[model samples]
Target: MDKTTIICRCEEISYEEVEEVIEHGGRTFDDVKRLTRCGMGPCQAKICTGLVANIIHEHTALPLSEIPLQRMRMPLSPIKLEILATNSTAFSAVKSVLDEVEIEDGKVR
Candidate 1:
């Protein structure tokens, strides 16, 4: 593959950048991501995840099965903290839940 070829258009990540991360002790997809920001784009890795995985496999010779899946996070959209704090209904709902879930000795009580 061309070193200049763009793998993640959203983040402007290239094949060479991914390989660089791998050469610098990036053995997993998450490692490459944290190092190169390859999969942390607007698309949320929907496009470049497979490509990154392939690169990792090619560089490290690790089996595809050993490659850990990317962590699935909640709130796909960026939430505005100001809006969440100012919204009385949402705040009250979260506060009520927290109030009920009492923590004792690092366990919910």
Candidate 2:
């Protein structure tokens, strides 16, 4: 049986490309993103995050939860770098709310 693979439609990435990134120390969410552009397209990690996370876990033998989640900024979506850079104040908000959140008895609070 022949196995076929695909990556970003816009970037025409291949599974090998993504796998290679993971193989080469690209473990964290942003690391994979920077290396493979897997979640850098218009879909902005929405479509590819789960797929990429699964791939990373499979290749690295890391559990799903152990993998560092992609850091989601305020927008939870991609925005122009310039716009973000210019509005430094907008980025001031914690990239994620870690304090108010309470993890209780191994369950989210």
Please, what is the whole-model Cα lDDT of each candidate in the order they appear? 0.81, 0.72
- For residue 87, model 2's alpha carbon misses the true position, in angstroms, by 14
lDDT for residue 68 in candidate 1, whole number 0-100: 83
Which consecutive 10 residues in model 1 have the weakest lDDT in total?
89-98
TM-score of each: 0.71, 0.62
Which regions of candidate 1 deviate over 4 angstroms?
77-109
Per-residue lDDT of candidate 2, residues 76-95 (tens digit): 77667678778577565645
Quote the positional error of residue 19 for candidate 1 in Å: 0.1
Model 1, residue 65: what's the lDDT? 90
- In candidate 1, what are the lDDT values of residues 32-98, reduced to their tens digit? 7888788787788888888888888988899989888886554354566687677466666554334
RMSD of each: 5.4, 7.8
Clashes of 1: 0
Predicted structure with the largest lDDT when compared to the true one: 1
